[model samples]
Target: MPEEFGPVGRGEAIQALSREVLIRRSLDISPSGFITIISIIQGVALGLLAQNTFPKPTVLGGIQSVTLLLVFVSVFYYYLTMSVLLRWAPSFLDCFLPFVIASLEIPPAFFLGNAVAWNAWLAGFWFLTMGGLMITTKWSPVSHFGNVRKAHRLLHDLLRELRYTAGIGGFMVAFCALCAHLIPWQRQGWGIVGAGTVLAMVAMIVARTELRASQIHALYGVNRPPFN
Candidate 1:
């Protein structure tokens, strides 16, 4: 019988090692690294501002404040996520997911301002939770893109696992937001926020999947670049 081999089996181990060494030697500090560092600093500053600006110290209020923090985190996450994609997976269209996810928060912000009567604390809590989830979700591409053929299959598989796990985690966060809005105990305006959150998540998933699938197809010669 023919030998059944994995991705690593396709090439000699020594050759792969040599190539990795050469690639590392040739690589410079990625521009994205600088951007990521700056964004993180900015995010931390924003978080501090939110903490100082909002008063009221209750669990619900905390949730609201958290949600507000999430807004800035989401933007920072998007910046980092895009930077990673542009640096490593330049050919993939996955970089767009962060922007889409970030945009979804705008409507919720407006709704929260206009409709919800919650204290600043609760608003902050919601923002922090939601923003954290969105930003973390955007980081999924780090794993998925790392799965490129050059790395060992083990590395690729690990990245794939991380990507899926993050995706599910993000989905759960959004689902929780949705439920919070829908529950009778919560405010009515939150329902709009919840609905928008769910829809945006769905859209993000679809877009990412489509882009990934297209890349896979290209690899197999079933499709071409430029997507269709």
Candidate 2:
């Protein structure tokens, strides 16, 4: 096959994208540690913010606010994972992330609700994101100028869409979660949970993403570097 030529981003995820357009990719999993730390900080901040913002919130509201925020931030990172590498069959696990990501405020919809539990889950989930980063870094070099392959093309398209859409969507969703602290939007916690579930279902049904990802992995061998 004839080779295509252009600059691709200098990372594992978006390396297949042309330099003609600006893009970014996950270079490594080292950022995992940073993500964990930041996630905890964000969770704490959210907790404090909720506590200070609304005096009438349930006793658990402060805690749930923080916990749910942690999950939301971590999920952003989860989707962020897809930007770099496609998981072959993590679909089943991915399906359950919504539950893992949050619990409840008034009734307390989750079990094992504790700071330790939240932090542990946050770290664990972030690890998955980091795993994706590591995998993508391994095969990043496979796609490059004058050496673009079919797998690279597919990856390029998928990754760009993943990053842009997920990045934007994550912020919006997080904002929605934050809104719960302010307005009485039908018990904001439930709204966040519902929105998360809807997004997850939509991703599964509309994207039908896992099969395509698995196929790309089988054909391209992204986990193995240089792809050739």
Candidate 3:
């Protein structure tokens, strides 16, 4: 059975073990902790607004306030997740690249959300920026203790992952742009854009899976014919 499975490469084995540890540690924390925390914060804010404890603002002002809040929350979440992932999976920086990319969207989303007042153009821009960020972060340098060599390896792996992720992002940008243009400017348009966004997200996930499989094949030398 072991032979049938082929020789286990040390790097592959380490990656597998590290991932298992990450999973186990993640499970130990309350699965709903993040959701619960967010919910509580939102509920408190809503209650304050309802009781007139907070001064009412114009619609644009409200949007800007919410966008700023989201930006801060997203940054905090990214820091927390990265800290945990780095501690758990020290070898592969690729695992955290997606999170970093996603986190970057918060800033731009905040800007566009405030500017467009939920306009499709802003929404589409948010998705496009998010996708682009994901692709960009994959190629960016990763540093720990300023070790140049280690950082380079991490960056290389990140770029490999990004190359796969960019395909998904490209599709999303196209779809979002289409929806932004096609949908009428109204609440219903926003709803349609939201649906399209979800579809794009699903596609991104599929792309990631396909890319990982390709990477594994390449790693195993399956793509290269043996010397005759």
Candidate 3's TM-score reads: 0.29
Query: How many backbone clashes are present in model 1?
Result: 27
Write one digit per residue (lDDT tens) for candidate 1, span 1-228: 998966654446644447667555334344354454545555554545455445535444444445545545544544543343334322223334333444333333322332233222233333443554454445545344445552223323333543553355455445555555456566434534533443454445334544554455455466534224
Off by over 4 Å in 1: 1-26, 29-34, 37-53, 63-151, 186-228
Q: Which is better, 1 or 2, measured by TM-score?
A: 1
Cα-based TM-score, every candidate: 0.35, 0.34, 0.29
| Clashes (candidate 3) | 0
Q: What C-alpha lDDT does candidate 1 achieve relative to the native structure?
A: 0.44
TM-score leader: 1
RMSD of 2: 15.6
At residue 35, give the lDDT of candidate 1. 57
Q: 176-205 in candidate 3: lDDT tens per residue?
A: 445545653643444334434434443544
Error of 3 at 217 (Å): 21
Sort by TM-score, top down from the best: 1, 2, 3
